[model samples]
Target: MTVTDVIDRVSFMDFEPATASFRDDVLAGLSHPIRRIPCKYLYDAAGAALFERICELPEYYPTRTELAMLQRLGPEIAALAGPEAQVVEFGTGDGRKSRLLLNALDRPASYVSIDISRDQLIREAAALALDMPQIEVMAVCGDYTQQTLSLPTVGRRRVGFFPGSTIGNLTPVAATAFLARCANMLPGGAMLVGVDIPKDIAVLEAAYNDSAGVTAAFSLNLLARINRELGGTFDLSGFRHYAYFNEDQSKIEIFLISQREQRAAVAGRFFHFRAGERIHIEDSYKLAPATFQNMARAAGFEPTQVWVDPDGLFSLHWLLAPL
Candidate 1:
């Protein structure tokens, strides 16, 4: 079976670097007094599919709110991106936001989708290239956070598209560093980023603890992954997905709780979890516009435009960098 056939002029590259970081990170995190797992591992195939479902959940406001804002600001986003621009997207899952910008962008010369999941990148990039034949499609499957990205020759003006508030996954310092890296990558470029604004605690809590439990499944999938890949013998049923809004931190925290005291082995080592103990999995930090703007400025990006949704639940920021 052809994994990424060039059906309609789209090019695909699968790059899995030689790195034992996954296992190393897993072992180190589990060895910690408070267990933790990097949020990136939560996107293994099953986890990615679960996330797609989560985006559709009624309680999840970021996806829909960001989509609405993108739809309304298509013209403005396109104009800000300017003409003959190239779009580089981070974590190109489903390519929903990319479609919005690509469709609106005028005479954009190329589209580069960078994602860690080869399956996702190939699928979405091929479809996008097929749908928009005028633009060059370069689908890259690799880690974007590690500062190891090297882009191919493409359009002159690069416009970065980072949607879905994925930046929320990083700490404030990391986010600033990430934005700085992006700005440095595209010297004379601009970017449109989705930032989830802090809102009512009740609303935030409901969003993570959806009635349908998709988010819960998404969180627990991390354990399932450990079991499948790391020789882990976790009793999936022994744990429950837990999420809450940390009022002080202004972030949504996800954890996996051991219902009762239990022991699980990973990579030939057994780890103990106390009854009702929690393993921190992820944090989704909601940022105020000013805070996000400050990050962009420090990253060498000047915020040119900010679009807010009707209810003030989300924002789309347009940041331009120097030549």
Candidate 2:
């Protein structure tokens, strides 16, 4: 059936009010000297849907590459994770990877899906619970980056699942801190993280700047979200999506550039934008395998094993927490 049909099977915990953080972050980010928005706010329902479409685009290799790798290596990953483990996935978008992972794990104790998008989180979690009735499902709605999440206590080990190379959205320092927090949260357990590898500049840029314009739509949806949620007066036509690989930073930087001078109001506050002025939207950093391992080690995790696809487009890192 549908997600609503199986909603009762999923346990949901909402830690953040839907709009407060969005409003506050929008105001604060727009007020900055260098106009920017926290990339986390980009996952409203519409944006999430656009992202799913982007995953299917031929230019977007990360999702397909990672999924293939997971399908091929699921058993090996399950072996490292061990049996009866509680799988806690961060930013559990659509729970596609989680389903594959939980299927591979031997009698996984439970599945905890955390995400900022509440509606999508509940929908996916409910569906997952229905599909895998043997495992318990708990859906947490919150910005995992900002909140100290209270997870369920289970006798078995807690395995953290962070797929989709979303870690690249955070700065290196922030990623390290985030991993350290995961280490604390899943003590004596382990983490399975998907990381995107640095590739040709043209390939990197094409992934975000797709020919079908889906990625552009995904970027612009942020403004639409603000207009709908925060009463923002943003003229969607006044801006254009721009993304490029910054070789120095080793990341793909995405921005919305104002086509002409204009002003947009959000939450009763107005902000001015000059022609060609850019509002930084996202950064997807590509770290080398050795570099990421070092960062994980610095974050109090023992880098156990890393599996890379033959194409060298993506990698899955398995890290162990100290006993």
Candidate 3:
């Protein structure tokens, strides 16, 4: 499971055309009356860099809160994950949070970090492997949702760690299905997950639409990615970033509003947008601890523990598959 092997695996998948087609589909969708795209694609190299900046923003509470919960509770989480367990992380961005557990675990036999961004996953996993040569590094370069994670069949225990309020991106139905998938993968074991607590509009809005505009830039970079990857002609200036709470949906909706009526073309498709029409980019669904636990229960996992931050902004949950 060398870093070079990870590159080869993804290279064999032929991503360029797939990404280009996805970009075209998104741009075409944006022109429709009900404009939207799955915002996960926004994490190309540049988008990843911009998101890192957004994480550091004072108003962005998810990253900081998750880090804090892990820092304080990681030892307890690690103790539950047996010494020889293989740590498989979904959406292992930069593998920073994973390292916190690695430091506390007696010694994980192997680490598998799955992410959609192939380059970032490989780079970070390789660095961790270099630092801790004893642990085997398996980098799966595919969309975490779609990829079939091949865990080390040899391990005594297979524990999955999905930290970050990332599960919030899914709807209740999707979140339940995803948790079920994790339970099916791990069987009778634990899965560590981070969830953001539902908060007031003031705090949630500030987190998404930060004053420094880093989040705004991160939202718009998807357009830049489309332009570069799909041979799209989108005037970046034609769109303005938007993030606000959709009170009815109970989620923060991120969008790129057309600043002016404009026409754009991508991948042989043309789109027309009216000024102020929002092309919804993403949704961050905040969870009440009870609501999240209920969802987990539906997915065949029982929430054994919840670690809340001092500010009550976020929580880390340890769920066990049905015995």
Q: Each candidate's lDDT (Cα)?
A: 0.87, 0.90, 0.79
Off by over 4 Å in 3: 1-17
TM-score to native of every candidate shown: 0.96, 0.97, 0.93
Ranking 1 against 3 by TM-score, winner: 1
Worst 10 residues of 1 by lDDT: 1-10
Instruction: Rank the candidate models, highest TM-score first.
Output: 2, 1, 3
> What's the residue-level lDDT of 319 in candidate 3?
90
Relative to the true structure, candidate 1 reaches a TM of 0.96
Which stretches of candidate 2 lie above 4 Å from their native place? 1-7
How are the candidates ranked when ordered by lDDT, highest leading? 2, 1, 3
Give the per-residue lDDT of model 1 (tens digit) for 164-272.
Answer: 9999999999899999999987878889999999999999999999999899899889989889888889999999999998888889999999999999998889999
Which residues of candidate 1, in runs, are more than 4 Å off? Answer: 4-8, 17-19
Report lDDT (Cα) of residue 26, candidate 3.
79
Q: What C-alpha lDDT, on a 0 to 100 scale, does residue 242 get in candidate 2?
A: 100
lDDT of 2 by residue, 149-168 (tens): 76876638999999999999
What overall lDDT, based on C-alpha atoms, would model 1 receive against the true structure? 0.87
